[model samples]
Target: MLWRRRAGMNGESDLAIHGATPGENIDESVRALACARHLPQPHLDRWLAMNERSRAAFLEIAQTLRLRTGQITAALELLEEISVRDATDCADILAAPEIARIRLHAGSAPARARELIETLRARRFPRLRETSTRLAGAIRELRLPRGISVVLPRELRSDVLTITVEVARVAELDGAIEALAARRAAIARIIEMLGGSE
Candidate 1:
């Protein structure tokens, strides 16, 4: 009496309720939550497959943290990856000090939820955070004109850099261009980092 994901001909997942036995009450609650949140069956199955402590810990988090479906899915994925990498359980990962602080953070539920996912992401990919921080510091050191901005590639997945200038007058555009030219050498270093020369 649960939902499971079935890969279809197109290699996409199809959701349907299937039969499995576990802690009946927890399973039922998981099913109810899954249906209510429109959680995909694969995620639901993953949730149910957890040990009782882990399942209960996550369910508690889902309720008290007021997580939405997408957040839950993201949290589930991060938790699994962290668990595998650290050789720990989801319950332990969720209860880590950093996450515990976020859980008790006084911000709005949505803010805390977002921070939780980002914190998990930072923990899962520590080097990415460090690299992003370094890149940001490099940009700050340039101290270019106010309107000019260097856009980092999303998740550092691409080496492309986008520079934009906002100006209301020809004089302002001229100033921005001159400022960009002044910082050309430093900007090239940023490009080198983005190109994985770090």
Candidate 2:
């Protein structure tokens, strides 16, 4: 599972699993970030101390910059266009055939170009998602030697919870339960910090 940082309303951010079959490490990172966001100072410090890469990814997700309203509106329009077009149509649009004719009719607007690119990206997202899902499934189904486990760590403030699985091979069914357990633990800590419970 690849961890994807998605922009949220009001300049907030959230995490998403890029593939249908999620990875333990990706789940751990998502949980750790959510936990640290509400944890007290010392606990947060300890959480960051667990791993540098984890800290960086957390910060990057937390610090997502907001786009201007105009940019957002343009992006929305692009999304609409993407929704109506098939993959082949999208490719055709991007091929830049009859560039001179297009240039003559479209005029020279940077915003228009940006919008076109955005539309292309929006159209491609579903395809990307499908491909990622297939790859993740393949990875999950791979067989590995015994005694090796994939460790995923979820951190919150000064606490770190790790999910470890002992499996004979890297089959699709392996490690998911342990990873989900760790994720739940991390979420529980985060909720507690948010005044729910310990």
Candidate 3:
């Protein structure tokens, strides 16, 4: 037997129970966890144990709930940190009842605990992730022999770059200047690739 709370078109919630074989129970339970507005603890635990898809669905529902409750910024940030794998196997995170429990225990503002479960979802998109990785690698490869540190512009915008060069005397200053001069073309190319005009 599996139990779920269903919301009707009239905005009322009803307890829906299904009695069936174990496999059927699991399916019904997963469905309930995916759609239910409120999750009872025991049922949440059962839903967490079902399978990967069910856990992912539960996390999605939890995210929706957070958004509807005006935790938009926090929810967006949390989405960046949450992964489907964490949603499936990590009971302390992406588990609705557990999140609610943590919320109560921490006495923090809404969506505070959820931040801990956030995964870098931007890295999941192949093109964006690939571009970011390539850009970072290219930047690292431009390291100067004098240990000049190149700071990437925030958001990779390429408008402003900060280069740190350590020099203790006049001779080192000349070397640093020459090193930077040598790398000027490479740096310009990198900036162009990042969508900035030299």
Highest-scoring model, TM-score:
1
Cα lDDT, model 2, residue 143: 34
Q: Could you list the CA RMSD of all candidates, in the order they appear?
A: 10.1, 24.0, 12.7
Worst 10-residue lDDT window, candidate 1: 10-19
Candidate 1 achieves a global lDDT of 0.81
lDDT of 2 by residue, 8-79 (tens): 563334456554443355445534554544444454443344333434333332323222334333433443
Instruction: Give each model a TM-score.
Output: 0.80, 0.19, 0.42
| CA displacement after TM-score superposition, residue 134 of candidate 3 (Å) | 1.6
The alpha-carbon lDDT assigned to residue 121 of candidate 1 equals 93
lDDT string, candidate 1, 35-116, tens digits = 9999999999888888876786677667657889999999888888888899999988877778767766578888888888
Per-model CA lDDT versus the true structure: 0.81, 0.40, 0.52
Clashes of each: 1, 4, 5
Comparison by lDDT, 2 against 3, better one:
3
Which stretches in model 3 have alpha-carbon errors above 4 Å? Answer: 1-120, 123-127, 196-198
Instruction: Score candidate 3 by TM-score against the native.
Output: 0.42
Looking at model 1, residue 94 earns an lDDT score of 79
